[model samples]
Target chain A: MTREKIIQLVNQIFIEQFEIEPDQLTPEKRIFEDLALDSLDIVDLVTGLQQKFSIPLRENKDILEIRTLNDIYVLFEKLAAEHPDIVAKLNKEP
Target chain B: MKPRIAITGAGIISALGNSRQEVYQKLLEDECPTRERDDWADQMYGTYQPFAAAVDLPVETAKTISRHFRRSMGNAALYATLAARDAVAESGLSKEALQSGRVGCIISSTVGSPGEIYASAMAVLRNELQDLSSCQFFKIVSHSSAFNVANFFGICGVQLSPCSACASALQSIGLAYEQIKLGHQDAIVAGGSDETTPIVLESFRFLNALAKNPDWSPSELSRPFAEDRCGLVCGDGAGIFVVEEWSHAQARQATILAEICGYATNCNGSQISQSDGASIAQCMRQALKDANLNPEDIDYVSAHATSTPSGDREEASAIREIFGDTVPVSSLKGHLGHTLGASGGLESAIILEMAKNDTIIPTKNLTRIAEDCAGLDHVTSSRPKRLRTVLKNCIAFGGVNATIIYRLADF
Candidate 1:
């Protein structure tokens, strides 16, 4: 998926998970501050993204470093580019 | 200047019941609350078999006088409030004590408001931000339970929320004990609560940390230190106790359950999940040293075993290293599940009750002791035993290990 497409999906996930509005979920929105996502929420978010996109998002040492919406978007986009088919499927969905 | 502290009052709401007497009675009979399935099944990734000693908290209990109380308070906070109220009432400390504003409150939770977090997320997904209530935001915060309990009881003194994973409750009580002994406050209400949530269950499932025995009933699900034990079952509940200085308690004629003799806490500062045996042992040693007691002086140990493979093994090793092979070690998590932040508080309360009743409840479902858990005298079945001093140990997710020494009240 493209950067914009990945951002859209991330935004959608945040909105769905936290009842946040699309406009409120800025690229700079911190998970805990803006979205109120706790440690478990972050783990679930990554897990859900991995399952939905069929990407291998292993829990690396740096996995805890992802803090902002933009950071998550970049990670998702990078993964999507590596798996075009998965990105295509995600993009095709409403 | 460490003053002797006394437990003036205690209250609890578990799958067992709302009051201490109710929960204690149920525990004596080895009764447990039912493990129910999650309502949001499809949304959850793995098979969720969550069990909680859930309290039937009325809406009014959660509702605050402030207009900001619109958000649905988390089950943890709701339960904390209930237990705190009961604790205050049982202490028989007049409103003047609270009005004096010298009272403090410390509440802890392992996983705070998983349901609220999930609900908030679902709301965002449904494009329902405006529909969401204000209380939703308040519930998701880590300190929500502590804040709510403090507010509910009008306790204006030093308020704290400790999130040491499973050890949150113990640390909370330990800190309260310190505050009272140091004269920071005359009285403090402290304990912990946990609510079963999908995220907590799914996280454990992903790590393959939950039991998956179809034939094994809920009561038999958590087999801590058992050789054939698969994993732990998620159980939820809360425990709160009223702590005061010995002189204060005696002056008020408060019923003393046990004396908070000593406390010690240390962090491994290493891995986030795995237990460091050396640090765990050191914590125990330090607590014993602080209490001016030897390893043999401790009559019982309420272990921090959650039935997880690595966790149970590490704790077992630590116990053997510290207290030798003959120490009677047991975990209430097998009975109450891992109440997380509330585990420390709940287990401490249970241990005190055990000391008072002169009986040690069985480890519950420990059928075969694990090979790694060998050389330990674990109480596999409930038996009457006179316990004078009990050591309660708790370990949390962030490499925090805490131990507290409680002595039976000598009147």
Candidate 2:
């Protein structure tokens, strides 16, 4: 998946999980402030992403620092570039 | 000059019961509240399979406090308000006293509004942003319980929310003791409340800290200090005490439950999630030293054993090092489960009642003591004994440890 596609997918997840408007979820919008996501919410979101993307996202430190949809999208993009098989797996679903 | 502080009134809502009399009676019978989650299975993140001492509180309690209703408010605030109201009523302090602004409230909780926050997150996922209330964000903060209680009681004095993890409740009470002793307030309503949330349960589960059992009985689970104890069950409730200057309570001829002799709290300043035996020992000694009493002078100890492997071992070692094997120590978590923020307050109230009744409730379900937790006189079976000076200890998640000394109430 491309960067834009990844951002779209991440934004969709945010909209679904946080009821955030698509227009409100900008590249600089903080996950905590803009979306009002807490530490536990962030953990659950990361877990959901890991399962959905079938990618290994172990380290709580890096997962906690994710602020924006773009940050999450970039993370997915990097992981996808490294593991095309997982990207294919993630893309196979809706 | 430091003023003498006393516990004028106390109230509690636990798995055991709602009122003081109810909980005390249940404790005497060695009965505990059932811990089941059949009613909440349909909710998101509702797969918590642990014992909880949940309250059967009414919704009118919340509506009576504030007209503004939001799903953000959890059971924690409701329990705190109920206990606070009972404490104020029992203290013989009218609404006029509360309105005078001479009273403050210090309530603490481990994680505030976990259920509400989790539900809100699920709502957001469904693209339902318009339904979220303005108070939702405030409820997610750790200070929400304190803020809600202060607002409910119309207490304009100093309001504080201490989030010292499991020790949060005890720290709040100890801080209130110091504040009243230093003439900071005429009376203070202090305590702790906690509610079981899926996030809390999952977090503990992820850390491999929750007790997983095939049998769904409350008595069999939460066996603190027992050799076969696996881990602690997650329970929720609130314990509130009316702490005031002895002179103030005496002037009003209030029923004094116990005298606050000495209280001390210290930080390990090392590991965040682990306890340091030396620091724990030092904290106990400091509390004893502050009270000007030797370790042998303490008649009984209410321990802070959460039934975790490391926590139980560390606390046992600390107790043995401080008071040796002679002191009769017990943990109510075995019966009440770990109420987290409310453990200290609930246990303190239990000890006060025990001192009054001259009876010590046994550490229920402690069949075989662990070898590491050996040496100390762990009160297993229920028995009536003479009690004078009782020491209460609490340790929390942020490396915080607190100890308080209580003398039997003398009319």
Candidate 3:
């Protein structure tokens, strides 16, 4: 719902699925180069993100522009603005 | 002339134990691993009995594989990878030798991940396809075990995954023998792996093939040819071997465990569920022909009898037809239940140990042979024997019959 929550959810996918440690979650960290995730792993990451955020992202072309951890958070923020209903639904989750 | 192939090493994880030595020890001690667990297949499938065989302990050896590389694996692949890793270790194959581009991997599972396959399908029904993980698809892919093993060791040679149900491992080893004998590869890691699920038991139960003889002694619950035998008890495990070209093994001074003398596989194409003795006999005869050996040369016949009435009877007849009634015939299923894809490879490892020790283990619960299965010399007890040549037979659900001949490496 919020920017920090979006960052937390994306960070959870990496920490849980990729076994990355918390210290590795700096927003400036490059996803592919620094995190060393491969193409298939990226697919996994996308699926993980979709499941965590409860959104359909397969058609979201902007995901291609994502280059760093901060980019992932910014993408979610942009998605929140675009899909207010999804963010509002999450905001109501209490 | 075809090149000789040597089974340099083998590894197995079975209900009997995690290591070959433990499995052999149990066989020698006449132990049975099947149990009436509360969580056995019957709990979910509501089959007649709760008796099923499973690996008794965690696969500690498989845990050594790093998690990153293991992310794509399922239970079947883990069993296979551990078995392959042990075989390579016992064979003293260096990492360089494995990655030499001349070593292939042939591993199999009937369906890659039976539980995952069903679960992913259920996810579709629930309109929750997005919930599937990134590694979920990889687990259920048909070649999961084979590709996982190859990737685990960085073996880049020919990779094949045979899916012939119970015949998979026999066919896998047979294919490896073909490849190395034909000079296509210097060596091949060959085997099969499978982990049982309630779904696996349900499939067999649907076919009326799960053992219902709950009153029998736990040790006798899966008797192959005993008159009171009911049906197979599903089991899980894996077996793997390092089969190398004879000349190459000798050049490297590797300890050859056994010689892959011959192999043959065929489909009768007529019978889908029942065992076809005529076709099985043809396969065995073909294997003997390839080995340039007569029926009398085989000291034993390891039958693919899964304790089902018709399966045991027909396989007995086939052995009698090919090697006559005197060849010591036995089914290891009585000990570990039916291991499906892993049986042929696991049993091959068993017989290799038998040949090494100059003794042969017998069918565990065979008290009295069924009348129709009477002619063959069914080994009813473990005893010292002049072991050498062994003919391994597998008859699968899809009318596939495979036979592989293994002999002592003394030659």
Q: Pick the candidate with the highest DockQ.
A: 3
Sorted on lDDT, best first, the list reads: 3, 2, 1
Query: In model 1, how many backbone clashes occur?
Result: 20
Off by over 4 Å in 3: A1-7, A77-94, B40-50, B56-63, B217-219
Clash pairs of candidate 3?
none
Error of 3 at B245 (Å): 0.6
Q: Rank candidates, TM-score, best first.
A: 3, 2, 1
Per residue, candidate 3 scores C-alpha lDDT tens digits across B1-411 of 668999888999888877887788888898888887666543465434565787654545555777667788888888888888889988888799899999999998788988688778889999988778678878999889999999999999999998899998999999999998888899999998888877888889889898875467666778898898888988988999999998899999999989999899998988899998889889999999999999999998888899999998888888878767878888889998999988889888888888878778899788988997888888999878887898999889999999999988458
* Candidate number with greatest TM-score: 3
What's model 1's TM-score?
A: 0.77
Each model's chain A TM-score: 0.80, 0.82, 0.92
lDDT of 2 by residue, A53-87 (tens): 76656563566567776678777776788999877
Q: What is the docking quality class of candidate 2?
A: incorrect
TM-score per model (chain B) = 0.93, 0.93, 0.96
Error of 2 at B97 (Å): 2.3
Best by lDDT: 3
